[model samples]
Every structure is written in structure tokens, then in C-alpha cells.
Target: MTGHTAFGWRTFLLRWSGEWADSLPHDEARDPDDEAARRARWLGFPPASQERVTAMEERLGRRMPPSYRSFLLVTDGWRHAGGFVWLLAGTADARRHDNESELADMYEEDLDEDAGPEEWREAGIWRRGLQLDVRSDATYVLLDPEDVDEDGEWAVYTWASWRADAPKRYTDFGSFMEAMYREFHSLRAHRTGREPAFVNDTTRELDARVDEARRDALRGDWERALKTLDEAEEYGRPRARGLGDQIRRLLGRTHLVYFPDVVTDPRYAPELLPPLAAEHAAHSYRGDASLTFPLRGADDALVSQVFATLEQVRAGAYRYTAPGPFGEAVDRARELARWGDTDQAWRTLTDALPLWRPLGPDHLVPLGWVADPVLGPLLTVERGRELLSTPRGGHPGEAPAPTPGLDPPGLAWLVDPGPGGGRGPYRFVLVEGVEPEDLPARLGDEDAEGAALDAPRTLREARWHLPRGPRESSSYEDRPVMAVGRAGAGWSFAFDGDPAPFAPRRFVSPAASAAAGTRAVVVWSDLGARRGESFFHLSVARDGTREYAFTCTDGEIRRTGDIPRALDPDRFFAVPGAGAAAERPLLEAVAEHFGVRLPRHALLNGRLHTVTTRSWTRPPRDGETYLVWSMA
Candidate 1:
């Protein structure tokens, strides 16, 4: 009957780490025996008070919500009534109760986690925990899910409450419902969705407002509910279930706000409220991390941005966080380290060294190894040379400037050990990683549009700038960006669009087709943008030989007569003097030798010329030769 006393409360108050449900008030604010008070005290019912126990159990059978069952089993918030108080234990309260709540609640509720319904039946321990409280007019015990009567469907559990103590049991919800209907004509079938439009109760308007807020919340109308819940809370007043928890759970699920700091505070626990002085402290830990900086400018800007983001991530400060992009960036960095450009990888390592401090050892050390696989051995040698200031015999200065022009440069081997005499097909294949600045100058025309991104690129960066080719849009929203068409022999050249004129710098070449057979000879002409809309000619030789020629000019092989005159008879069919003196022209040559008339205007006045020469035999041991020329 006093401010600090538990004079009429059923359960004693105790401090818990997290939040704890407050004890429900029983009779007597001193001895007040109302319906709500009866339900509140039902938990304290003793085994001898069967009538009170049975009534409370029946009332509970009528009022619990459905999702509570699933959430209870999964989270652990079990509880039971004993004497004048309820004893609870379960998963939902594990963190708060040191896992004790789980055992007490489960046992009192007759929930045998280890046994199924069939097992419980076979073991005959199915008599649920329905205890009676002899002192009260009514008391009840809640039945666990597994202990439910077989005929009960919608009614999943039972409880008891009584006007006075007696020994009686109800096997089904029907028995409880029949008793309730008989005693109180007000009893109605509580079909969940069939609640009437209005019930003439003093709290009807308040209930409507709360129901409306709940509906808004379930529909993800957070902003609307936020506005409405203020009014709903006022209406629900002192006895209402806290709307703050619902709001907190919703906001957390939507990730629209920080975790439920204020609502989850102990003040909302149906008891004393505290001032808003308390604030949660942040939890911080260190581990490896990766970062991607989206820099859109020149090379220097790119490098600086990349370095800065890496630095910040290393410093353990970031906003709007998610794990996926960071993980992907780390993976990409690892892959980049695997490339042959050990020096570049080293530079990357040096740039990102600051971030490595926060990362765990596994990520940091492996990153270094990835960046410089040879560094371990080099370290051993370098360790031996304590005074690195002394001059070494073979000191190579700065590396030579890259070769300029049309051809992509071959990969350089600065300290290769001649493969250490290893012999395999490894000699034929090559891997080249070109610096962005050197790439366009090496492959595309000087005046070509949209060639600004010549540096190294992230996949995101590449998607933003690359042509994406004719078959697909540049947006790259489609599922799989990389695809291999059906294999075939002929080569197919694809362009992002009808390519512009060669422009003295840009030119096209046929790509190797999907097939591995004889390649198609592609000749791209109509070279000017006007009529030269990116068309190509397929030149197939009868002898299974082919040649691809891309040009912007017409040629001199105009008439059949000009074909013979154009043929270089000395090299056409006759072998040179040093080798076999005479030999028939190769079939491709025969076509050229016999006077094949070229298309009209098929000449480009000195537009193209053969840039390479091939010999079928050793020079002095001469063999028949074929001519390649460019004409206007």
C-alpha cells in the first residue's frame, strides 16, 4: 500500500541485466478481486485449489495471440504461476535471467523440449502442470503447446480461474467455453477476424486508435504509425502494452533508425520510469577490412581517392556501413595481387598498409604475401645485407620507358631466372597487364571519343565507362555480363556501334570466331562514316587459307588484265634460285595469278600496306613467294 512496497504485487521485484517484465498486481491494492486482478493472481494458484485453477486456465485458452507461440519457442520467454506469484523461465528471458527463466517456464508450462506429442503419450507424463490456488476464488496454470488436448485446434492451450478452491479438470476448450457461456451470457465465439465493428466499452475509442496504429505498422506505414501512436499511447494509458517495443522492432527490421535504445530501456517495463539520462555506449572491435573509393577524374584523383578511402577504413571510421562491398573489395585486391606485376602490387600494399593494423593477422599477413610473393625470400637476402648503403655489383637504375605506339607491349621480365630450365607449353602463352595511360595509345585512335578512362579500373568503374559493345547496353543491369556464344569456325567482329572512319589512328580487326577451324578473312571497308558504316567482307580461299584486310581506300586491282599485271611473276609461282628451282604457286596465289577481277573502286590510293612479312622457307634456300600490297 506504499510507494516502495510490493504490498499487493504477486511477484517480487528484482534488478535484471536487460529488461524484465514487472510483476502483475493482485488483489488488495489492498484486496481488490476484479477480473483483471484475478487473471494477474492466477499464476500463484496452488495444486489444491482446482476450481480457481481450472477457471483461470479456461480464460487463458480464450485470449492468447497466435504468433506468441512461435516467438516463444524460438526466443524463450516461458513463465508459470505459483502461490501468489508467477515463476518464469525460457529462451526469451535467457540473457536477462542467466537462462534460468527457460527451465522454470518450460517445466511449469509442461513443455518437454526433448519429447514430441507421441513420445509424451507413450511415456504417460502428459498430465499438464495445472495447479490450484486454494486461497483465491480463482487461479490457473497455462498448458504448453505439446500438452494440448487432441481435439483442440484454434484453442492451443488451457488455464484455470475459480470463484473458490476445488478439484476439477477440463480436457478440452469446449468444456471451458461451455462453462463460460453458461455462467456469463456475454461469452461469444472469439473468432480472431470476426470481432464486431463496435463494443460499447469506455475504452472503445482508445482500442480503435491502438488497433489502427497496429494496422499501420503491420502494413509498413511507419511514418503514419509514428504520428498516430502518440495519440494511441495516451488513449491506452497506464495499463496498455507498450507500443514502444512494437515501434522499436519495426524500425530495427526496416533499418530506418538506430537500434531501439530508448524504448528497450527498463523504464517501459510496466513499472517505474527513469529519466532519459542514460545512453548506450558503442561497441568497437578490430579486424581486417577493404574499401573502394569511387573517384571520377584523372589518374592522380583516382589514386588519391583510393588511398584516402583505404586510409579511413584502416582508421576504423565509416558511414552507412554494409559488409558485402568491403568483402568484395578485399577479394578484388587479393586477385590483383596474384598478377605478375609484383611492383604494382607492392605499391598497393604500401598504400594500404595503414588499414592493415585493424585487420586480423590472417587478412593482413596474407595481403602482404599476395602483394609480394617473392618478398619473403627477398627479405632473407636483404636481412643479410645489414648495410644496404654499400654499392652492389649489379644495380639496375630506373626501368626503361615503355615502348610507344600501335602494338600492345609484351610483359617485361625484370628478374626472371630463365624459367630455371623448366620445359612446357608455358613458353607460348603470355599474360600482360597494361597501364591505362599506355593502353589506348597502344590500341585505339588518338581522337576516339570516350577513351578518357585509360587507367586501371574496378568493375564498377569499368561498367561506368566502357563501351559494353553492340550486343548489350552499357547499364549492365542484366544478370550475366560475360557470355560465350556457340562455337564456330568463322570469326565474328562486334562493334559497340557502327565505328567511325579509321581517322588515321583507329582501325578494326576481325576477332577469332567461336570455332577453331579455318578463320574467316574479314575485310572492313566503306571506311568513311557516310557509306562506310562498319561493314566487312569475308575472303575465303579455296585452299583453306584466309586473310582479313581492313582498309579505308580503294585499290588498283580493277580489271582481270590488271590482276595479271599486278602479279609479281618472279615471286608468284617460281621458287628462287638457291632452293628448289621451280614450284607451282600456292592455291591462294593461283587465284591471284589467273586474273581475279576485284570489286569496282576496290582500291585505296596507298591507304593500306602489309606490315608483316612471312617466309615459307629459309631465305637462301628460297621458296615460292606471294605478294601483299595496298593500293588507291
Candidate 2:
């Protein structure tokens, strides 16, 4: 037998034995004479002679494939598992293992008399195959001698005597063995609750060394653990590379240095501590699958040192460019603060301005860092100042003043407006008591109730206060409100309740509207009614300069030329008969007056009647005396 054949047989023995040993139940005693053990012993016997292989071939009247023949030279017979114990027939058992005769007999006994010629050929599986394994269970490993290729290798198959169907086939014996071995290993691993590591005789010593290293690591003797792993590497350099690295990292935990409180301390000088600390910190953060050591587990003094280093680096005291350890330190400090040492966390952050500055205008600190009441107030104040100083575009002190003549009404009209801009959809609130006769005049009067004259107010002037509720609802209540105007043909209606009315909302050009001749504005009570819950008010100045304004209960208020296509009133109202015919006169009047198409449905749904008149002292009741208007 050749060296290659001997090696292959030996590898098979080691793998089979390893799987069996690993798979045995802990509570069950293993038998030394078990089938797996018996086969392993047989494989160690002298290689089969050429004459013996030839004699077995003659008895079967068919030659074994080259790969199988080579395997036979190493070990003539073997047994293993995959659902069933597979038995490879040897030269000594050739006469009894002659499966060709048995196959022919099975074909004759099971052939269907009514089957078509092609069907019969397919069903006569026994005629084309030879059973290699002897089993009472009726499932057999088969070899298809009739399907031999140019290489003289027969196809292998697995056949079940109980099922009268063609056997499942494989390309050759080598592939068949390989597939069986993989499945066997997987099955054994599952049963044993441990992964099966294949170790042949050649690498047995190296594997033993690895096992010793693992034991050492578990006991925390990292020095000895790594040394043992190095010995394994000497025997298997390339293959042991990953194992070597893993051991080193595991051993590295012993040397982990905590963040020192003082940078100037002799123990924490740049050359002595940073490099070693960085390496150990990285490993600690990564964590071992078996042993985990968190950074917060370090003493408070050490943690203080870590932050001190970070602060020094931030202040350009030490040019520590590596961000990994620094980031880890921040995360560790935050974690510690979350677990109750918030003051230390705050101090760490206050000194690490360089790290926080790069985090953007918000200088977003971790939520835990600011959750502490004592630390929260101080941090927020400082953070807010830092954010305000961040250069956005204009100088920090040069914020543009509010647009003139655009203030909202009383405190009720004021909203929180949130951080970015004014909140909520642009909406209109009809100012009652003003009539059509007040056209173009009352809108310009600074003293007129709800007029544009009283519109421009500062945030302080609004004096808006918040009410408590579910967070989202309460937050919305704080949005700042602003007044809006409609440029009508001869008059305009003041919409004082809109939240956002500037560019991106109403496109305010304070200078543009002022330069244009005074536009006629009507506080049309009935016109607001003819329009819907939310209506479009067209304000036309005496100079014929017209401006279009559409109010929505929610969403941004879009101006004349910049309205999105989806919001186009024509799309919703262009269809005929969409609104009551009685309102057509008022719709036509507003559309014709403004020189634009009118949204009739919008007029019909206007919330004008919902307004409470400024002159009325009490809420209106059914049949009570109240000011009423007629569009006619």
C-alpha cells in the first residue's frame, strides 16, 4: 500500500474515533469493543495485497473504482455512522459480499409485468447496481457498475430495499465518503453539545498543546497560557495564527491600565502609560467570550486618570491623535455616570472640550450624563452657551430682527414654535365684528382689532406660556403664532392664528409689500363663511396689487406662486357641481375680484361662522341676538 493510502485510512480512523468519543452520553459508560472502536482497530492492520484486491474483483465480476481500490488497500473493511452503520466489504469477505447475484434476484422478483419498456429499465434498479453494505434494515449503500465512465469509476448510490424506486446516486466513491464524514461530524457535534475538531496523528501533539493553553487561560494564568500557545504555533505556524492572537488578547487583560486622574503623575507620562493603556483598553472593550472585564470595573482613581488624559489631549497638552482609546474612555465615563457617579462624568466632559466641539453645534452629551439633577443644570447651561456660540452663518451677535408688521394677536395666538422654526400648519382665524364696509381701511389701522398694524411682536411681547399634557400635545402648544394677510381685489382678511408665516411659509418680503401701493383689504365675514373650514383670502390693494393666501388647519401656508401642485385648489374644486350653487355668486365675486380661479368647495367649507366676534361679551347661543352678515 502507498503512503497516501495509509494516510487516508489513518485520517478516517482519527475522525471516526474523535466523533464517537465526543458524542457518547456523559452518563453512559463507553464500551471499548463498540462497533466504531472495533473498526478503528481493524484499520490499523497491515495494508491489503494487490492479489487480494484482484481476487475480490473477480468474485464480484466488476472492478472497484480507483479511489475505492486505493481506500481498500489501506483498509479492506470499515464501519461508521450516518443514520445507519455502513460496512465496506473486504477481500476476505468477497464471496459472501458478491452483491450482483442478490441484485439480479431482487429485480426478477419485483419487475412489473404491465410496465412499459422504458419504465421497466428504470425500475429494474437491481440490474444496474451492486449492494456494498449488508443490513437487515433494507437500506443499503450501492455501487452502479453499469454506469461506469471512461475513467472506469462506477457511480455510488444509497438504496432502500423497502422502496421499489431507483437508488439516490453519487458521482464516485470518494465524494460519497466525504459527504458521509461531514454529516457524521455534524451529527456527533449536535449530540455531544461540543464542536468536533478533527485532529489526525500528525497534528495530535499540536492539538494537545492547544488544549493545555485553554486550561491555563481558564485559571487566569495568562503568562503560562500564552507560552503554551506559542509552543503549538511552533508545530503549526500558519494554521495556529488565529489561535495565537486569541491567546495573546486573552492574556492582555492582566495588564489593563485604568485611566489615571492626573496626567502629570509619573505613572501616566505620555511615554509610559498611553500606549499600554490604549492596547489593554481595546482588549477590555472587545471582551472575551469566556471572561469579560468592563472598563467601569476599574477603580475610580484610575477612571479619573483616563478622563484627565482625555482633557489634556483636548487642550493640546498631549498630542494624542488616536481616537479609539479616547472614545472608549468617554463611553466608560458615561457608563459610570449612568451607574451613579455623575459628578465625575460631568467633570470629565467639561474638561474635554476638544472632543465635544467636534461633535457639532449641539455638542450632544450622553443622556445619562445630563440625567443627574445636580449635573444636568450645570451641563445644560454650559452646553447651551457653546451651541449658541457655534458659527452658523451670520455673526453670533447679529441675529436678524423679526419682520415688521407680522406679529400674532393676544397670548392665545402665541405658540412655542419649538427649536427649528414656528410649528403647526399655517391656518386662518377670522376676526369677527369687521364688515365688508370696512374694506381696505380697517386692515391698515394699527388700532383696528386684529389688524396687520398690531401684527409684529417679539417673543417676549407674545408672553406665550405652556400648558402641561402628554409630551407631544404640550410641545405643539408652545409653537409661536404669527399673523397672515390676503391681498384681495378691494380688501383683505387678517389671518392672525397662523403659526409659521415667513419664507418657506408665506415668503415675507417686508420691503416688497410696503413699496407696493396700499392694497384694499376687507374683513369679509360672509366671504370667510363662503370659503370652507379653511379658506383662501385674496387681498387686493387700491393700486390693484393682489396677493393670494390659502389657510389650512394643519401644514405650512403656501403663498401665491410657490404652492405645491398637490395643494392646488383647482385640482380639488375644478370639477363642476363640487360646491353648493347658492355660494357660486360669492365664489365668483372672490375669484373675479382677485383675477384667479376660485376653489368653490373651499368656500363652502370655510370656518368663518366658528369665529367669536371681538365685540361679543359671551359665547353665542341658539336664537340669541348676534351680529349676522349677508353676502348679497
Candidate 3:
């Protein structure tokens, strides 16, 4: 009751509320019953009388061990000792595993040379063991009478046929039951979002603090919860570190923590495992079993699988992912690895990591493997240093050095910046029959009182100069700082804008129409913020007529003109009552449809030849009042 691993029958199972009504089967839940099945649902039955315990001991030809005998004194039998083992045998029903001839080969077969002295893992283990569970799932619990300790406590072994691991050995039945209690908590947290909050009455202070910390985490007060749980964990409180792990995930702060259970979610395993494996391998090399315990039962089956996966990945034979930046990069990485250029392979993965995005809530996007297929085998151990050594995602890193010689990914960065800071409320144009250098002169035509382009600036510098007026205050109100570049076969003409009353009628239509001039195809996205603002519009013009136009308001796309056959707005923007959250996939689909990509170095990182478009500002079009402020 006092030690961390203490085992108390009702004390632990009391967490389940001791509500026989709730635990009963549906047929019994409503009708009261004394049926054996119903009695079993109590998770503990009535304590065996002294005469019954003595009779069972005599029948078994040996006295029951003290730990198990004491357990029966508290409760004759127990249920759900482990996740799978459902019905634990009481004194009257307990049977011998040695009596089952079908298990002789399995139990009597040769033990591997390195097999531990744990009785449950050796040849003829079952011959000396008393089976303690009946009618179970995949797990079998055995008490080895031959393995009694000085205190007359029977050694317990729990073998889960579902896992490849050997029967896990516990020094005593009490310790084995305690491990089952811990596993139960893990299952609860994974399935139910960790309900009930408090753990128990014994560690009320720590339990209450952990519960309050969990609440804080639920309220997005992650920093507070993390700090509180960190303190609680120092007391070796149950679930304190586990809850902290969940918070660390929410904050993108899982840098230091590592253990067998380090990767909280399977999706994280791909991104996090490489670094973890690197540390594990390092510890293995140094013979420092501190970081990594000797693979006690069956070779840390999880880690062995991870290395096997890494081997497959390095050999270019892992299962392929969906077509995207990450898949392509992985292909290149594997090729490099195959060619014995592991360093370059690592750099390739790191470079593409910026573009990686998690497939869904299941993944910590951009920080996760893009469209990650599995947990193990995403990265090689040698390459983990590049990923872990480089601090990622929390802050806006300095712009990447210029890569002018390389062609950029077009304009896709406007849609998704991976795990980086938000990139949105975008206003940009795609024009056919134009060059990156020509966008300045074309955009200048849209100037109300003859606009002048500002000297080219980097994205960081350019964002600084937006929401300002020219020295001649009347010259411009919203000077657009833009990175003009080539996108695929057309020219990507993008402009920066502070939030606005989305162009009420079509400020960009005129620009699109003028820029169209009976020859070129121009597409303009005059978008609204994902939150608050409701205005959103996309237009495509060609040969002096609007080819397609649509506005996203009221959770639907209202269109004008014949929509292009190649694009589907409904597929992207048609989330009913989804609010602003629906807009993200819409923009992403647009980028995907056009194969629009922009280089990270140019659009996100280092300086590029960026020009401030001649005032994208227009006056109160369609009776819209724009909110304008200035640092100018």
C-alpha cells in the first residue's frame, strides 16, 4: 500500500468505482443476479473460507503460496488481471498447466541459449506452474511454486500470446497484479481520453494535482499543466509523466523525453523513432544499459522491429507513401543511402521535412512523416542526428540562404507552410503569358494615382512594410510586398495583404481583366482570413472574358460563369457549418490542382527579388468599408 509498486486488491480496482451495476453484463445490468458470470464481474468475488482454501491446497498436493493465499483471503478470485486475462481462478477451480498435454512441446521445447532463469521462460515451465486464470482472451497467468522466494511468495508469469514477447516474469503474484493495474491505466488513457481525472485516494494530493493539470491541458493551458505535472512526476506519481507527455505533444515540445513508451501515438513513431533509436544504439554501443534496459524477455521487440524497418527504408524497399514532396524526397533519400551516401540522404530528409505535413489529427503534421504509413522504419539511425540536432518548428528560423540557381516549388507555400507559422488570408495572382520580371509593370497599371514599386525586399522585410502609405500619403494605402517568381508553365505573381473586407465586388477582376488583355489567362485569389472575415473569392479570366469566378461565403461556393472543368470547388470548400476551418483544404486543393509550388528559400526563408506591387488598395468597392491602419 505504501511502495510505488504496492498491490492492494480493492484499493486499485476501486478506481473502477466498485459499481457492480456498471460492470454487469447487459442482461444482468438491469436484473440483480448471483450467477457465477455476474459474480465474476465484481472483478473480485467473496473471500474463500478457511476450510475451502485448505481443501484446495490439499487437493493440489501443495500449500498455496502466502501472496496468493493472502489475495484469496481478501477476495477468493479476481477478473481482468491483465488486459486479456479475464477470469482469475479461485482456490476451488485453480488448475495445473502441466495437466494440459497439448502444451508440452510449447513448454518442454528447448530454451534458447540466452533464456533467463525465470521459471516461466524455461523448458518444462508449465510443468511446475499452477494456472490461475480460466476462459481468457490471449493471456495466461501462471504461479510457479518452484520459484518461491524467501518470503514464500510465488513467482508469477504472464504470457500474452498476442505479443511475441516471452512470458514476462514477476518476482511475486503481488508484483504481477500491480503491473496489470498499470496496463489497465494505459488502456484507459488511450481509449477514453483519461476520464475520472483523479487516480486514487492514497496519493490524493498528487492525484488531484495531476487531474487539475489534465484539466489545464484540456483548456489549452499546456504551459501551466506541463510545469505542474513535472513537479508531480518527481514524486513518482502514476500518470503524472504520462499526462505531461500528452502536453509535450500539444506544445511540440517532446525533445528530451524518451522511453519504451516515448512515442505516445503511432503516427509520431516515424518522426520520433530515428532520434530515439540513435540514443538507444549509442547506449547499446557504450554497454550503458541505463538508457536502454537489456531486452529482458524477447529483445525489446519494438526496437528490433524499428531497426528492421530502418533497414528496409535504407534499402529502398519500404512501402511507398502517397505522391507528394515527402514521398519524392524519401525516394531520393533511399537512393542516396543505396549509393552509400548516407549523409546526403540525411540532408535530403531534413530538407524535405520542412515541406512534410501530417496527414491528419493522428499525425503531428510537418513534424510527422508526411502521409506516414507506419510507426517504425521511417529514418535511419545515422540520419537521426540531423533531425534531432536541428531545433525545429517553435520559432520562425532565420530565412534559408538564397538558392537562386534552383527552380522553386512555384506558389504552393501560400497554401501550406508545413508546421511553420500560419501562411494565409492570401492575395495573389497567376498570370499566363508573363515573366516574373514583368509582373511589376503589370501590377503598376492597377495603381489608382500612379503607383511606384518599392525596392525589392525579402519576405521578412517586406511583411514589415505592409499596412503603410507611401511617403506621398496619397500614393498608396496597402502597398503589397510580393515575391514574383515562375510557377510551372505560368508566372506566379503573389502580393501580401493585411486582413481586409475581402474585395467586395472585384478589385482584382479589373486587374485580372486588364492583365488578361484578350490573350493571357489570369487567376486571382482575393481571400479572407480563415477566422472572422467571411469574404473569399477566386476568379479565372482569359481572352478578355471571365472564364470562372466563385465566392465562398455562407459555407458554400456561389459561382458565376462556366466553371473550369479541371477544378472542383465543392470537393474542397463544401464543409457544412465547418466555419473558417473549411477554408484551409480549399486553398490546399487549389494549390494541388494547379501544381503550384514555391521554393522554401525564396518564399519562406532567405531573400529573393521581391517587389511591392503598386498599391493593391482600392476604394470602398461595392459599399465595403475596409479597416485600414498604418505604421507609416
| Best of the two (2, 3) by TM-score | 3
> How close to the true structure is residue 385 of candidate 3, measured as C-alpha lDDT?
26
TM-score of each: 0.22, 0.29, 0.35
lDDT per residue as tens, model 3, 1-632 = 33322156556555432432233344533323235434444567778888889999999999988777877876788766656776788987797887353454775455566667753345555676899878688667888888778988888877766778766889987777767765554454344332344334434666788777755544435557678878666545656765565445324344554522335345445554443444444345544344334222324655565565445443323444434787698778654432223344456766765555544232222333311222122343323323433322332233233222322343444545445455556566666667666666666535422234344344566566544465333322455566565554454555443333354443445345435553233334433345455556677766566777777765666788876554556665555755455555655565676666444433443233455555445655465545543343
Which candidate model has the greater lDDT, 2 or 3?
A: 3
Best by TM-score: 3
Determine which window of 10 residues in candidate 1 has minimal summed lDDT. 604-613
lDDT of 3: 0.54
In candidate 2, position 44 carries an lDDT of: 29
* Pick by TM-score: 1 or 2, better one: 2
Residues 1-632, candidate 2, lDDT per residue (tens digit)?
12225576567655555655554454555455454454454422346799988888887777777767887787776656354644555666533224453764665556667767755554454555555665324666766766677887777777666677766777877667665655554444334243334444435655666666544433334456567666555434222333334333222222422222222234323332343333433354544321112232345665555455444433323322223443455555444332223334444543343333222211111222222212222233333333222222111222222212121222122222434544323323222223332422432323223322321222223224222332221111112322222222232233333333222222222212322445433212211222333333322233434344443222222345443343344544454433322233433444443342211111211111111112211234466544543221
Each model's C-alpha lDDT? 0.26, 0.40, 0.54
Residues 230-314, model 1: lDDT tens digits: 5444333211234433343222221222212222332321110110110010111222121111112225543343344334333
Q: What TM-score, to 2 decimals, does candidate 2 have?
A: 0.29
